[model samples]
Target chain A: MSSSLAQQKADKVYRDFGLELEISNRTFFNDGIYSGQKNNYLSASIQPEYYLEWSGGEQSFKAVGFFRWDQHDNRRTHFDVRELYWQRVKGATEVSVGVKKVFWGKTESVHLVDIINQTDAVESFDGEQKLGEFMVHFSQFTKIGTFDVFVMPYFRKRVFPGREGRLRPGSEDGLVIDSRDFSFESNAEEWRPSLAFRWSHYVGVLDFGLSYFNGVGREPVINDLSTFNALYGTIQQAGLDAQLTTGAALWKVEAIYRQNEFQDILALAAGIEYTFGNVKNTGIDIGLLAEYLYDDRDNIALSGLQSDVFTGVRLAFNDTQDTQLLLGGIFDVERTTQLYFIEAERRIGSSFSGAVEARFFENVDPSEFTYVLRQDSFLQFSLTKYF
Target chain B: MKVLTITFVLLSAVVTFGAAQTPEEKGLNVAVKATKADEGFVSSVVDLKMILRNRQGQESERFLQNKTYELTEDGDKSMVVFNSPKDVKGTATLTYTHKIGSDDQWLYLPSIKRVKRISSSNKSGPFMGSEFAYEDLSSDEVEKYKYKYLQEISLNGDKVDIVEQYPVDPKSGYKKRIAHYNKDKGYRLEKVEFFDRKGEKLKTLTYSGYKQYLDKHWRADKFFMVNHQTGKETELFFNNYTFKTGLSEDDFNQNSLIRASR
Candidate 1:
């Protein structure tokens, strides 16, 4: 036996742990249209993770915890168990049980087929953050493809930003939705069981996933606009996400069809990203991205990305610090609404990294959902230290 | 006398032309011998420490673990999991190299628990901001390149044979590479010089501290690469290499990337 393996056998212990601390601040260019709204906000977050593996790497346990303290907006200051699961791998099949997060999507502009976990909207505006869902997961790998089955016993409600927050969903009268008054169409409410099945495979240059989900819908439906009453409807959704990689270009598409209480909704987000490596021999790579987003509900769509175009430019410095920048804009197809954003980040030192992000809302029409936040353009800065 | 001279000349010409091997055949023979000498290592796990230095001599370090699985039919499969530069900790990349086609690669971002299919055409781009490109780190299958034997010379007091290779991939950034193989060390690779697309010297890589494992295969524990055009350098230190670790194709797939531990 190798010395390292011999030493590992003697010790019989394998573990990994890390801690991260982040401090962030955001400043608005204009005051909020609502009353008693702050122009600036500061927040801090702490995240720690622990992992242990044994039995020849067949069985393992992992736990990741997150806590955030915001200077304003108590709804944004919360804690969550991002991942706490025990997994076992035996031959071609694997099983896991506990709270975990799963992400599924292929587009850059918007995510239409990603489900399973509730979005943590109060934490970030990008919709990438999610709360863990309790489930029993089974995965099998075969010659043709990989199959995954999930049985979630409980549902986690999607949270929204507070009234004083910048990006909350608002009405024409500047009234924010009160999630406290939310209702569920299912008799079991939050205790409703959710089931999902997905088959993913790669053939040649194309990688694709087809999935079906049944249970409570992730998006809240507004039954009464005046009272801002939100309802969670039990629905069924079928999703398809695929990407074709050809040379320096990647073509991606995500489509979803949902049968909800009010009606059936069809949505899609398709895009292409082409990268030019080592442009002009400067060791910098530049990528051009463009996408189209469509929703059948149009103006009444909850997410408000209906019939839009997204274009972006990504720059990778290819330096030791791993510096990167992305500039993007989303344009409404039939309206004057437009959103422009820029994000830049780089490593500070051995363990620290910093990022700057800014979003601009311009020429928003009253009919569009983003009109309420026309003056909510803001810039944010954040620094994180990892251990 | 004139007829005898003509016969002698004709005989010598036929003997030389029929018996001697061309430079291409000699190069292929060397490559085949080297490949044969290092076969039968089914799998391995190793730790790598990368040190990157700039023109100003500032240094940054990164640590990672690598697992490799060899396939008899196709090229090898490798998985790399980052352990340090903690912000990107637990991020992993999986690659399946093929002998004739473009390689398949996937990147797993631990923060989002997402696996993304990446374009392999970016093989010329620097890996982890190091001097080594993605193509440099991929499994070097003999079929990927066309080789020609150059000459034999003395390097570091040992006899060495120089071979020139031309990449078969159309998207390759390098025009050619000159590799030096140590003749006395089981035909192991010793040094390489890269030429850019414009046929200019781009970088030089030197391997040292070679140690034999399994009583047959030789592995270099250190590699230093210096970029001539950019005045940047990178050093890789390999440690704790163990062979036949029982890794399979399952350990080099997308699922493995997601579950890869630090």
Candidate 2:
């Protein structure tokens, strides 16, 4: 009876979706330009999801479709199927099939272990959105832990903005490259099947996850540094993510061991977030965050966070509208390169919100990848209204 | 927050009494009795619409879904997710209102894809830019405040017991709050008056549209809060309430807030 009642409460053939229209003005402060020029443009996207769910049926179906249009960047104007899946739960086992997004990680600074779906890079630089992948998945929840296995049949490549978008790697005395000028490692494309397994459970106050994946890498190996051409590589990775909540502090760690054609590397991010309830008797709150990121490959790593330390502060007003600020900086522990960033957000009302972000790079080394894009320091503001 | 939570040890500092039971004990007894009158609700889910009117009479509206789960020990857990005003849609807040010490609160921002813990110091701030304060969202528990019976009086043609309560936390925005309970109706809360730390009336909240659900439980379907200092008002209209939702504690945590809008 309770199961039927829960089904009744969630019964639906058509669920919910929304349209978001965003306009951004990007400026590059430098004597030279590499990929995208200083230009302002508007982008709009619509996501409508459908669910064929029965009040008493054991099987359920869902589909989500997303499409976007950009004013300047041709590659940004595209469409994707975020999710289209069917699932069923019987006793302790659950099964699902079709295209879907599976998230697998813990930690704030980066999502090191979440690699089921390829990132829709043009959507945002944050690597949060994922393009759905075709897969057959199964999971079993038991008293010991929950174990999941996946058989993925296809792959999706990472996309970059058109020649007009901002934040591209500098090449050959600041030559701009088009997003269309992209290639693969070889005859390899999407169609090969991949295998993955994950186990997660709560041990006392700690929630931990162990994942093993043997698939085509989501991130590309920079084959040609001058024009920044991406060559997707095959990789086998074992990842571990864990979090321990103790009082007002949370201990977070994300570690990944991976092997590709060029090298075998182990990377880790370990941090503790400790919060002090009220600051100076004011209702506003502040938190101190410190994390250390390390990679065995060190300086030659593409993204260049190797052997770095990041510390930041978070402020929360805790009002009904929810206002917050996060400011932090990452410094090379063994080098002179440092980067600082600020991210803030607040609600305008029930229907709208505003966000602001700023990033500045200082003392970048010539050998580091960040030196090329040193002029990309920028401030971004966006106002989004829901419909 | 743990610092202020540690200060909650002062709650045990209430002066003890001897022969003549003081007004403090009497007011607390009334509160405890009223709290016990409606128990074992387990869980509830409700939909609410909030209307805000400025002093100039311009108005705006917000829609949300609120879910509450009762805890036999510690505090009750509640989650609220915005459903309308397209910009703020899918935003959610999860609160654990402790029986003692400070409450634990977190807000989920979808744009940043992160969850932030709320500072306990600012519970008195306006809720959603509305007249209601953050503390107003709390589920009333006798332990959250220390009460003193003011008097028995007739308020707005109804006989009521006027009581004054002081927040246990020193960081509370209000110096004290006044609650008028309907004396003849099993001590039901009819109205509340909030005073700032400066001892000035800050806001007044009125409850009406009494509704009885599950036979024994009573809930106010309409709540109107007016900010005396700012000359603004917010009216909350509850659409429906469902009890015995069978919601578990796992549904009121950080993970739930991430998908609250979904």
Candidate 3:
């Protein structure tokens, strides 16, 4: 045994821990807010994570806890255990069982292939944050690729902010619907079974994934359309995502096919990002991205990305502060609706950073998912500190 | 008798040419010999602390761990994982340095949950707002520079060889760089002075307290850089170097970048 490595291996406490706290305050861009809540409200969150690795390197455990308190919306005030899992790796195979979050696909604007974890929509409309799921997974790595199989025994439903939340955008008649009123196709509710299989590989400059999942739909279908009450249905989905790099540009594509008792649908997102490094020979680098989103359901889709084009630009300062800016817009080609968004962040010092996000909607069609929230355009600012 | 005279003149000419080597040839010979002393190390792992000083003399510190997998040909792959400065902790940068062309770089942001490919053309830009530019920490290779021997001199009571070199890449911000190596210490690198594109002195880098490992490789324990233009400085302290721990190519690929950050 190498003496230096052996000495390091003697320490059984290969562990790490961290805590993060964030607060966000938002204000509306329009004075015609229908919810009757105060223009500005406060939302705060605390997250703590812990990790441990055995000296033998055969087993490891990780846990992350999250809690949030909101002044405006009761539903927005919640708690979640994002991860608490034990994983073991032996030879070319690995297995893990616990509450965990698994992310898949390679698209920026939409994630059609990621279905294992429930979306924490209240955290951010982007669906980047997810609530962990209880599951048992087995993965094998081979010369050709990695194959993973997951069986999730418990399911978590999606979250929406309270009635007083800015994005709540009350129904057509400004009626606030409580989440408790929603019904499920199966009385089992959280005990529904979910199965997923994914195969991912890299060949030269191309990276790709093929995945299939069968489970209760992540989004609820509106039943008794006038009441805004919904029912959760079961469905099966198959997806393919790929990306290729050539020079300073990356080409990406994501496609999915889903089926349920009511209908079968197809969705796709394709885009390209080209980087122009150091504009004017300066420290800033910019990337131009454009993508088209299409869904067979047209305006009936909930996410509202159907038959629309998304264009965005990302700027990176490459400074010690790690400053960045991203601005994007989704424009409907068949209608006169558009959604514009911008996010900027920069480090205040070594341990603290600040961010601002603004979202706007114009000429939203009533048939679109976000139409009710048309007048909810608002700006948000947050500060995050790590220790 | 005619053939003998012709042979004699040819032999004399060959001897004269061999004695007077061109400056370029001599520089290349020195670099080759210096690089040859560090062969067969395979791979190495290290942890380092970087100290940044601004013009006003204020200072800050950052800690990082790094692993390098050296390929037999082409370039070496290296990944650096940040450990301190809570906001940037868990951030990582992966680089594939090629001797013949610009390097490929990727930055993994824990907040964004994505690995972004960054521009390598701005290598002259300051590294994390420090005196050391991105190009300064480049993986040293013989083919990356064109060298010319300046002279042999005595400095700091030691015999040293001075050489001037220009970067092979056109996007390089420096017009040229001058390096000094101690002749008595097996051509060990000791110092370097950088000149900007306008041919003005920009920065000076010094290394000392080298510790040898694996019986053949030498690594400096302390490295410092001073920016002449901005009166800024940065210091690097290297510790716990381990060589040949069986790191493979698979560990240096894009897929491993996520693992490296954790």
Candidate 4:
């Protein structure tokens, strides 16, 4: 009995510490219309994590620290504790406390329902990067579905690019955003209490989630373009995200109804993806994607995807390197503006990987918000090493 | 005189039973016995390493951790967590293999902390660029196939039973599979040959290094699969298997997937 117990203890191995380093270089094809904008830029980021688990893996603590250095944008170069939390799981109940990031959407074209954490705008153009929010979360799993409840004590303000940043509103006629000059509709400001709930489950071929949030909005309302004045307001939002998986096709939809002090909005994004597997015995899979986005706010909406159509194609090489590529474009229905992009990535060796991305903006109308970025088409390359 | 009479009676009974059973019934009986040989293992966790080789002899390796929860009536629930090949590290996939219709699969991407429901229709495609298909690694339920017994033969000096299995699901990549079961042992699987949808020989998988766990379950520690048409190969090694680790249905859910991935 003693020998077997010792053998069991010897077989368990733990990976407690991890680190990742990423370096990127970007070049713009045409010089930006704004002054102080550089044609070339370099940036680097490091993320270190420490994780520990005990009680038969039912309880754990994790901490992740992130730091970035940018060559041009001072505001973009910053540090954050992406995730610092303690989690416990017992039976069908799970609880987590401290700062964490939560995602809640199904559509790929536009995330209309994912509003938990504030966007880290300077990190990437896709708005997928998020700043962690401090919260106490509880989850209960039942036969009907999974219920998630979140109590956020403090709100995270959205991080934007600095004056020297390429993607920000340009200084066409001395117009630049003063990110410091921001206000909240609530008296508590950044310390305002927030609450959110979500129920997600799968039934047969359909998977869906229904969520509601009452808190400070993740997206700030830009009051004036001249000074780029912004306001964070308390809002109530009800959202639904669903997906239907049928054969080689996936149908997705995300809709939300939100009420705020400024406006009441209804937005929807629906899309479908179909894949042709192993085309002609070449071991390559190609998927076609198309989505339609609509918002009642129309052109004034902060998201440029309003009243637009997005189309894309994805290719999976199914090779040993795990190579993949995506080519996509977003076309504005009311205006002549069009945005095109291509992204490709492949594993280099055991621990390193590389990616390439390029974006183009064409036929931008002056009335549109993205007019300042007309000459900001750029290509970027990034290498990441994981340890 | 009494012992000789009893032996004669037992021989006649055995011959009569063999003559009464049809090839299909015998085949199903053997398949059921092989599956039952590894039953009663409530839950298990094992580490797996997959090595992929191309026609040019270039090789790449992937490491993963797999956990399984055995359900009494329904199909098993399993999760595969990627640990190495750094880019895909912290990614995991959860699968619920049903006895009928289609299986449900979900993928958790750690980079974004998102859980996505993936279509299981592409059963024929390679898994992680390996020779094994998604269907090949799915839970083996008797309802998924129809079996017919072939002639018994000696394989490497061991008596073996060969059975032809026809897939029930139309989306399955294979039309039929020929499985070799060792008769001298506890009806353990020794090898299998897969035929593609076009009725062409596609791949061959061989298993070895059988070890009994919990005294009742048989598991193979090594698996080697070779694709005939593509000239590609994949080898899998399973290590440090622990059974009955007190895993329940909760461990196989999407919530657990996200937690385990982190």
Candidate 5:
């Protein structure tokens, strides 16, 4: 099968094929301030993407695969498929079924209520956090507004044993709550769907949109039926999302104020960005973003009932020399701890880019916390080359 | 002494005649008149195709299309259709402009199966990531810019006239602009140099391949602009020049922007 596939690809390449690859080295240095040990961590990732367009744009297919290896304090290696999807669009409707980046928000950095793709840093800490999911989406154009809806039947589940222990599937060492862990197998019959509406008027200037999605939050796991019934008394089953964009600013806010099923989450985010140039000119641009998340849950273990506030600013500078610079920072404020991060990126050329980032975290009462240390700082450097 | 007095009066009359028509005033009048005439001619519906090229003269993208434009004395309407690049096929954009206030716009994307309404204040932003802002594509009527005749200049070996224009929009990114127009082509603009708010040269737009359509109407087939600081360039090619489609204000309505096609 591999040889036949290779032969067909070779034949297609002779006709017309495009191939792109990216390799990067990422390293993180920590003074062991929080971990109580200095650590140097290195990770390398290789991503190869292939595009094949056949017969005058009739049938085209694109496939992208990613592989990564991490060398940390403990030698553990893992690799996963990032994106593998095929798309076919006939006229006003298009369909894609596979693992893909299902973006569903209008904000720049923070998606106030978007639940499609799991976030990066938040997902990285947990092995069960998967970015893409298996789903089928359909989009249609209309005179009043455009409509987009997707059906996700399978969800990636995170199996967390407890707050201090590692997450392992089918483990009973610690108390397990379904509200914190996402399981696709438990609710396989339940289908999650999302809808988006867009409307525009005037010299292509003004645009507005509203979106809706079902609950994609983690389901609660109740060992006893009475406990499940008690928790189920006050769960709201639906989530609400909406966004608006004018020429000057793009704004979006989302909230998941569901009462019962187990997770009570309310997240709100707003972002504003402005571009100065025409489609042809590469010039200076500025963007400002701010986001806040409030999660209220009873009987859940991780971070026990927490509210996080995030604010960030991004500045982009692009010149005709194929040189670009992006400088930004994000400040995360919680009740007991405050985290600040600043990052800058410079594009050397079309195929290469580098970035440096610094992160600092401070705990107010360090002496009271025994499990996790406070006052930590980490620096990271990365160089990426795109083929 | 009587002859000298008569000669001085005659000389003074000649000087006053010339002074009555200063070069700056004449240039402003010509610029305004040309803009008004152009706007009047392009007020109705027109079918156009644009070809974009890069600085290296390679065709970066080609838009094979037809567009319907409806304009009023104080407002304008436009609907654009994309016929190339199968990924963006069946995409239609509808825009409405108000003379005294902000305009409203909408875009229908086939892939997303949704129509998105765009806000007006973003008119100064680049269209589709191009250097041309949404306002740049609107009708360039006399009122859009305040004019000042700079000087007489020569372009493309033709003796031309130059005028400066400052955008009336308070939020405009450009401080001022210099335009070179062809005298014989109904004062049609040949090129323009845009200056930043700091009064430094930012970009230059050149119009070429001027074709005379409908005898009295002159149109440029190619519009190219280059950003001096950034090497990026954008070119627009106009083709299938069809005029007078008998379209009325009703045709430029929101419903028509999504459904109408030439």
Candidate 6:
């Protein structure tokens, strides 16, 4: 036998343990009247993972768990549990079950933060909450390509009590109906399945996926057509999601057209991000994102009220071993406003780092539609410790 | 009967004299033979733990690591991982051999969120502040060196064969290397002398503490190398050596390097 083959046989005879953790502090600033008072926050999170593989075997198992606590200005402490899951592998097939962050999209930097649901602190949909669902997923690799599919049976229920705080559109108080809330007659009501397809070639890769459900997206409610017709109808129309990545750029576009019960709406979104430079390290990344959301139930033009067109440019420097600086600005074409952010990070050692960031929100309305509506200025500094 | 006895004695003397060849020739033959025999060992995926000693010759730091190495016909490619000191753990370093030229390299820092391809062309550069240079730690196949028999030597009371080898790669920072090989242990290399680009002795690498595993393979548990001029020393401890893992080329690709721990 070859020496490498012998080495492979030897690797199957031993096992080891590994662990990692990260702690970070984040603060938010909203100077607009809608944002309430300037709030400072500190949060510490711990994520632990373990891997086990039997000797002289191809089977392996991995488990991960996370816990976090955040302290706000009101002395209120919020605790969060993130990423609890177990994965098993046998040959070319891998399976994962439980609550885990599922990432979709090929964009270098995802811009439609609202469309995607997962746990992230950097760019959450305004007033959006982390959503988790109990799911089981299977993936297989073959010479032809790689294929993956996920089945989520239950959904997370999110209810926002009326509060005086910064609120984005589509985040208003509402009672959502889904598997967690209501019982329906169809099997679709029992479980929602998301399908993803990926094809990789020597030159590039392409990925696409679609999620179909009763529309509550994990919200629970009684499926009474009469009482909850408006919301129930939207849940019936499966949404279309897809992403494409090739060469130096990646793009993702998604649309949802629902006409089920009481909900009648059409929403379309598109985002394109391009990376330029040698190996995409020290270069410019620019993205264009636009969304059109229409609500016909109320006979109101929600599209014009919620529609937004944004263009952003990011300049990355010193992206190698020592230091990194990122300067970027987002222009809101519909709102006639601009937001600029700058972040700089330096490595102190292998496990420790410090960063400072500043952000400014400005009104650039040449039309001068309304000066009072103009929003401006926010800044924050943070330090992170990775274990 | 007396004449037959004399002929047998002459034949035995000739055989004994041939076995007494210089250690240099034996060491060179062993080095060449070992590489030729292991040609099919193309790639290796392993978990490594290294203990770095301070200037006082005392263990000062420990690094837990894992990596997948691709030993190609051209050169060695590896995805190095650091899982400690929180900031650097998830980072991966990718080293690839240039198809028609020298080894090309790059590092992907997750914290910085960028892939920085190495631009430096120096092979003798220090590797991550260690005593070993980038060239020395690389996978240098037997074909890269031309060998000549040197002399016989005794180390720690064990007779060893010594040989000198000159690197064929123009980018190599060494004039030649002198190595000592043990005759009984599959002729495994025991020590090596590295010469500077200017043809001067630069460093010495010693392999000790041999252990047999699976009744078929012999491994050196401890490897210590000292810089001749700088007086700096580095020691590598191989606690686990596995074989026949059945890893494929797909497991050592670029995406695997990035999403390794995940």
Q: For residues A1-387, what per-residue lDDT tens digits would candidate 4 score against the true structure?
A: 356754664455455888999999999998877788888999999999988886666688889889999999898898999899999999789999988988888887788899888888888788888888899999999999999999998988877777777887845675666545789999999898999999999999999999999999887776766667788889999999999999899999999999998988899999999999877666789999999988887545566766889999999988888899999999999899899999999999889999999999999877777887889899999999999
TM-score winner: 1
Candidate 6 regions exceeding 4 Å error are A1-30, A46-69, A73-81, A104-107, A111-133, A154-192, A200-387, B1-32, B39-47, B53-62, B65-83, B86-206, B212-218, B225-234, B245-262
Candidate 3 local lDDT, B1-262, one digit each (tens)? 9999999999877865878867887888889888777777788889999998878887878899989988748778899898877888889998888877667777787654566555566677667666777788878888989999999999788889899999887777789999998776767889999998889998899998888787678789989999888787999999998888556666665546655665
Candidates ranked, most accurate by TM-score first: 1, 4, 3, 2, 5, 6
Question: Which 10 residues in a row give candidate 2 chain A its minimum summed lDDT?
Answer: A23-32
Q: List model 5 lDDT by residue over A210-282, tens digit each.
A: 5554544433334342222212122233344455555556555555544434444554554455544323233
DockQ values of all predictions = 0.60, 0.21, 0.30, 0.50, 0.13, 0.09
Native interface contacts retained, candidate 4 = 0.73
What is model 6's native contact fraction? 0.15
Better of 3 and 4 by TM-score: 4
Report the error of model 3 at residue B40, Å: 2.8
lDDT of 1 by residue, B1-262 (tens): 9999999999977876789877887887777777777778899999999999999999999999988898868889999999988888989998888989899889998888889999999888898899999899888888888889999999879899899999999778799999988888878999999999999999999999999998887899999999999899999999999898766788776776788843
Better of 4 and 5 by TM-score: 4
TM-score of chain A of 1: 0.95
Per-residue error for A306 in candidate 1, Å, reads 1.3
Q: Each model's C-alpha lDDT?
A: 0.88, 0.76, 0.80, 0.88, 0.51, 0.50
Model 1, residue A310: displacement in angstroms?
Answer: 0.8
Query: Model 4 residue A201 lDDT?
Result: 94
The per-prediction tally of clashing pairs is 0, 12, 0, 0, 50, 36
